[model samples]
Target: MSETTLDTRTVPHDMDAEMAALGGMLLTPSAAADVAELLNAADFYRPAHQTIYRAAAALMDRGDPVDAISVNAELDKLGEINRVGGAPYLHTLAASIPTAANAAYYARIVADKALLRRLVETGTRVAQIGYTGEGEAAALVEDAQAEMMAITSGAEPEEDAFFRSFMPQVVAGIEDRANADTNLVGLPTGLNDLDELTRGFRPGQLITVGARPSLGKSTLALDMVRAASVNAEDPAPAAFFSLEMGRNELGERLLSAQARVAFTRIQAGTVDDADWARMAEAMPRINAAPVAVRDDVNDLRIIRSVCRRMKATTGLRLVVVDYLQLVETGERSENRQQDVSAVSGALKAMAKELGVTVIALSQLNRGPESRDDKKPRMSELRESGSIEQDSDMVILLHRDDFYDQESVRAGEADLFVVKHRNGPTATLTAAFQGHYARFMDMARG
Candidate 1:
């Protein structure tokens, strides 16, 4: 389970006590499928139970008789299915327990997985409760509606009601704000220029940062990540998928950037005494930050699952994929481009579904090197050119020092806003302190 990539599609087992009583038996296939669907929710937990339920659902969905044998067979189809126990274990559970009398026991087995039980409870809450349109039916609906309004209105409680009541005006105010901005995302990094360009990379937006090799794409991403991690306004908890660079390599770069020391000097520990003191001082500050690193993960499912876990634990606000080209799209197809396309689409969808801002590093196309200006445009996003079309915003990085010394002598590196779906293209020059591996606003320089 810990070795391979995470299967985001795998169902979780977070069914509640009421639903767990059904186990793999319940009302049969339909129940299992519903249970599976609920467990896959972003806020859901108990992936194990979800997995078991999905196996049962897929089996039942095959149009076969809903029985223990069929459920076991379906479990077999879900390979690498490790949970200390398998379908036979589930079959044994179903055969051994009776729902009417064993509700307590059923709940006990899945007690540790809170989300799993809640998923089951969600189904229980909605089952057999269809709407009615007339007479008593209409009255019941009105009563329910009134109760809902009362709860959500946030008004003072009256006698017999211990809780506060909801106000319609307040509800309307919130609704208007949401309607005004559908792309509300993780958090702002406080970089005025960047924030103004994309409204702070809100939830559901797949933001791409691209550049030719060694043009500091990852550095720019790190700047954003670190700033967001340390922000005060709805600070985003971030996760990074680094397909390149080891823990030590990345650490050194960050230290150099934060401490404003030459990266090579830090790496070699041959720096002047003052620089060494600065490095020591920088360690504690950067280490105090809450950025979590997962050096090993290649599967989209695992990434999603881990991210969901991170969100549950740390109030996740953003996710960063070091390089899009390295992630496997779970499709064992021969046409690599199509597989990559699927990955890109899935990433954007995941951004929206999870309501977390996703930032992916991309490789610039080769066409720019041959151009007269050597500045990247949207067409430079290599391999999957569609990245330009899918991403809400694209930041192209260029260091004129890579070729023109005169440009560097002038003290400039240009961040070209190649595509701003919601705003106009603008360029911002930042001081490129190559020795320190840092970028500071040119104004400071």
Candidate 2:
């Protein structure tokens, strides 16, 4: 193919639509502000359009006027007026549009073309990766999926949601909290004190539960997952992506907790008549619950795909990852800490993108045990400080009995709300039933 032919065919763009959108923006500042939410300067295929839109956006953001003269002056300040064919081009754009009423429509045209161009670029990159054949077949597939997902990730943009546009949601949320009998605004976990303190797990919130080994991190996560998804009055399906435990093992934990049967007895097939009856009773509730379990997933791409599918089908509200450090990020980094930081950042992003509350279990360092009190803090999060930084809530699970076996608080576990972004922090106690792998509300116990 000739160079000119290839240039015309390869890049996807609509110059008429770009100019019309710019003209609309120049004529109507209100429409410009709303359209800016859907399209950025980079979304314009032409460099000149990008320059014009950037100048207009800067003026609008600063509460300055946006018009041909003002935008021209801003571009002149940016030394881009001559580069963009001078003030004549701006006038031409304004003259091209008949009216500013179709500003959003024109902006949508520009956005769609931009997305198509991005799709072409992503496909090209994927083809290049496939041609090399350097990585494993499975890894390559994952990489391709990740690349496509990265392009589609911002499908719903809230970046430019102004306060006036956002006030209705805020007011509705406040009214929901006020009219309710309880202060829990989000999905309740069936644990009263913890729910009160944290106001339930709000959507788009990333919650990290960390502890040393065998300190009930998994147990606590399971309890909360059950409460939010299965046991809640109106069942909202939730996802559990377990990298540390197999599906059967996790099922057994839920079974033990629900049936109130001993875990050892259940695992050993030593259930008596009464235990069998309890298991039979528990089976119906467990089967009825809308919780999806997946143990094979250890990467964010797969996790995101599963969550997206679940949310579309059954209205998924929460997602639980049994331990963060175990996620396979599919990238080779210089150190484990860097890999963990990347994973944490990805999980946080996933939570926001999917609009689901994510609870990821993490491992704490030995700093808690080294201290006299043996209570964990935010700094004890293992591997990555980014875990603490990215999370909206950091909950530290500690059992004094785990360190001092003969202490008076043998079965009591202290859940320290170390870092909560929206509420007060305090330590709430829950009864840890080791035999059942259950964490129960202390008041009930």
- Backbone clash numbers for all candidates listed: 25, 0
**Model 2's TM-score against the true structure:** 0.67
Candidate 2 per-residue C-alpha lDDT over 225-330 given as tens digits, one digit per residue, 9 for 90 to 100:
7787667787667899989899999999999998999999989999899999998988987899888989999987678767764554355788999889998788
Candidate 1: lDDT over CA atoms? Answer: 0.65
Q: Which pairs clash (backbone N, Cα, C closer than 3 Å) in model 2?
A: none
Candidate 1's residue-wise lDDT over 69-130, tens digit each? 66556556656244616656565546544443443345444443544444444433333232
- Using all chains and alpha carbons, the TM-scores for the candidates as numbered come to 0.61, 0.67
Candidate RMSDs in order: 16.2, 15.1
Ten contiguous residues minimizing lDDT sum, candidate 2: 1-10
Model 2 lDDT on a 0 to 1 scale: 0.86
